[model samples]
Target: MPKKVVAETERRRRRPTRQGTVLSEKLIVQTALRMLREHGSAGLTARRLGAALGADPSTLYRYFAGLDGLTRAIGEELMGRALDSWTPTGTWRADLRSLGLAIHASYLAHPQAALLTASRVTGRPREIEVDETILGILRDAGFDDIDAVGTYHAFIDLALAFAALDAGALAINDDVREADEDMWTSTYAHLPPETHPHITATAHLLADRMNHSAYPAVLDTLLNSAEARLAGREG
Candidate 1:
């Protein structure tokens, strides 16, 4: 038998921990997500997770090789939720917009989980499926191979970047986030116009816009560029 297969077989053969909780991979991943929400990224240690699940920490290895393996599973879980909730509209531009928004919303929904997993290269199932779907969307819309890949790269990165950025804001305590938001009004809006003319001029706009996620506007800009490119090709 192959070493990898043999190792997996042995890991699965281990019985439940002393607590006798019948554990599964899904349960572990769910517990991890909850723990991340309640305690933040640093609090998601094996010991704490095991305690939450009422199993020994070592028992988790039966389902995942280690915490890193578990982290990748958590990332996959979030991606799966994003893909599952989205229904493509068949029009490529509109579909792409919907898909990007779905992903952004999913990560923001689980801010702490997004903070830990959004930037990871999971190369897992849901991630692969998302990549394939985006590539397919661009290719089917008449983009050549290079253009499709370029757009796919930018689209996925932009969504995940916003997810991470916005999730960071959400992951912070309400006090800090409120204070940061108020800074645009309290600090920038009141800036001395003589010394900071540009900011002073735009302070109201900044206060209105800066507190909101730029994901939707930026996503539209990206899609608009792609649309113009397609129009150019047709012309």
Candidate 2:
């Protein structure tokens, strides 16, 4: 089916459940996000979602085609939230940095949901808006068509890659995550400096930094490279 037709069908319904809970696309998407957070991805089944909304499982088809559609909706919601309070700052690098951080922060807020949807393209309204905004920033920053497209792809892919990696770490169960974290100190730190000279020497620094996200540093590097490319093209 065509995308507009699908969108129209999804939006054409808003009904009250037997228990009087009003059901709309926004409500369902928000509830689904909550479900993913509280119950994890595996727990967000049709039956559970229906029960949470006081509706029949089949009722969700009125708003979303299936689990995949709902997943995309949830992804769109994440994208929307990221851009909710953000506006372009006119400086391309600064604006891109802010937008990148916002998206990463939003995904990490719901790691389980992010695990399912962070890397997928929804092609929905907010997702399109984000892409357009990025392209606009690049074009306005004096990048020509080829450079703008290339840099836009790199910037978005880099941000999403780190978001997925960080969210995956956050999605691990608490006990296991703690044990994994402790390995930096308890395992690597204790390695003999003779056989494992480099790791042992930098073990303290590794442990201190391992717990933090590298998105910001990586983002700066990417922007710097893009800036250099722009300058080279001008020269």
TM-score of each: 0.91, 0.93
Positional deviation of residue 134's Cα in model 1 after best superposition, in angstroms: 0.7
| Backbone clash pairs in model 1 (N, Cα, C under 3 Å; residues 3+ apart or in different chains), count | 0
- Candidate 1 local lDDT, 58-84, one digit each (tens): 777767767888899999999899899
Candidate 2 per-residue lDDT over residues 76-145, each given as its tens digit = 9898999996887789989999999999998999999988997899988999999999999999989999
User: Which ranges of candidate 1 are over 4 A from the true structure?
Assistant: 1-21
Q: Mark the regions of model 2 whose C-alpha exceeds 4 Å error after superposition.
A: 1-15
Candidate 1 has an lDDT of 0.88
* lDDT scores of the candidates, listed in order: 0.88, 0.88
Pairs that collide, model 1: none
